[model samples]
Target: MKQPSIARLPRMLKLVLTRRAGFGVRLALVGAVFTLIAGFGEASAQAQTQLALKFKAGDTYQQKVTTRTISGGEVAGEQVKTTLQQEMLISTKVESLTEEGAGNLSQVIEQITLDIGLPKGKSIAYDSNQKEFSDPILASLHKTLGKLAGARFEFTTTTSGEILNFKMPAALTEMAKNQPGGGMMGDSLSEANLRRMFEDAGVSLPKEPVKKGDSWTRKASVKLPIGEVTSHLVFTYDGPENDTLERIVVSGDVEIAPAEKSPLSVKLNSTKLTGLTFFDRNLGRVDSSSMSQVLNVTVAAGGQTNDLTIESQVEMKIVPPKK
Candidate 1:
């Protein structure tokens, strides 16, 4: 099939590619999930078993998230690359627990530190707690991001990290007018990215338990400025490690659906997403996860087409709960 508008696609497609920055920030909200009260006692019971995500009530803990992203793609046939890193501290308090083991939690961004490499040949690094830096730009960004420190946010999640919904106070989204990305923190407040984070959390587990070699499918889709990406992931439970029953293992194959209708005749040449995740069923949280994805797309406009592939990897680690 002949593709659509390629010339107008560069700008919008770039927005879609780089927009993952917001997702990195939103993922910090993937905390305090389901509890495990049901038992896999007998075979009959096991057949009906579902992994529960229950968080302990009245418990407070801290999670440190470090994300490093390396993406390389072609821009107008020239090789371009970006390396970005973000580190944030999240404080979560389980306000209450449900009979089903879900947790209603109050959380906050206690700290944020970042080194962002923008595609426009600009890099900004700052710590939210620092009041000053030798570089005026860094100092301004520091003070700006500092505003989010200690900003109380609310989230409701299942014991398994299924984010029902979340809210960030409007006041917390404001950034100083003179900092990076027009001082808006790269539009981190966008609704689309937030939904993607929610979707990301939802697919961490299958609907039911499985033994090794057993597989299940999770279908996830999200909308972006340029188009929407629909993914079908078949996750296989790799079984527990020989030494520990505490950790459950999982691996998966990822496929992205072609753009059926796009704002600018966008067509995907190919896409791939694959990775592994470790979930501590007892704690009802992910211990760590690593995933790599590659996207090949073509944009047709004015009877000409451009092609590029974007590859990225994301990893997350959570600190054990405080006793």
Candidate 2:
């Protein structure tokens, strides 16, 4: 073969080297993109299996709650019955969190409405937003309920949603401050009951990761007009129901416990509680929740006993983050 020129040799080698380098760079870029996508998919799968609150600061939830109670059995061989209904608007925010994942939250009441049926075909309704009411008693109660608006309460909880500490306010006392007979409804709005109403409804996660059919138990002592009630809240994991949501089922029982001696006592009572919640892993919170309770109770007072049954329901959902 004839000898080639030295200048042409250098150009030929340069072209070959440049082509190899470019091919390697393109291969590396493709691999990096694939790795990133695979990592994202793996993280999502892990989240669905893991059970924990893992709350972020400043997250907020809006809740609508409704409660209906009908308590009627027999008093002195006469049938007696009454129905009570209540609706509320509540907002919950995670104020701050601890290194161990515990969190402090601020719960605010925005609105409240109530309807109570009285004897002899009489019924009264109270709406805090109403400017005027026909009955003075209803008007007074409306004004009392107004105090709840803009009320903020701070508390701490475990990742599982169990209430660790509650800054319970003198709710009934505050609601009754300017009312004519604050004392009559004061006990019915006691701090203990209100605290449980907000806290116990929280999502209680399992100690360990759970799959379908897994179950756990939680116990709480709540005070109500019928008396102090100790309840056992049972939780069941139905596992991952869909791409973004996890389903949890709840059922519980409440029993009258020995409490302070007072006319406010339950002679006999039956209780049942059921609930379901859907959690969004990507959002890191419950998307929506619904819970209901039924109570059939016999209330005893000075020389008399009254039968009562009550049904209560609550639903909640996370709202978009504040700007």
TM-score of 1: 0.63
Model 2 earns a TM-score of 0.70
- CA lDDT scores, all candidates in order: 0.61, 0.71
lDDT of 1 by residue, 99-187 (tens): 77778888777778888787779888878877668987776665546676767877777755566667766664443223233223433
Q: How accurate is candidate 1 locally (lDDT)?
A: 0.61
What TM-score does each of the candidates earn? Answer: 0.63, 0.70
Residues 257-307 of candidate 2: C-alpha lDDT, one tens digit per residue: 644655566754677799998987676667788878888877777877677
Model 2 misplaced regions, further than 4 Å: 1-48, 76-78, 131-136, 139-144, 168-183, 186-192, 258-260, 305-307, 318-323
In model 2, residue pairs whose N, Cα or C atoms come closer than 3 Å (at least 3 residues apart or on different chains), thus clashing, are 69-310, 70-309, 71-308, 71-309
Q: Compute the lDDT of residue 2 as modeled in candidate 2.
A: 88
lDDT of predicted model 2: 0.71
Candidate 1 RMSD to the correct structure: 21.4
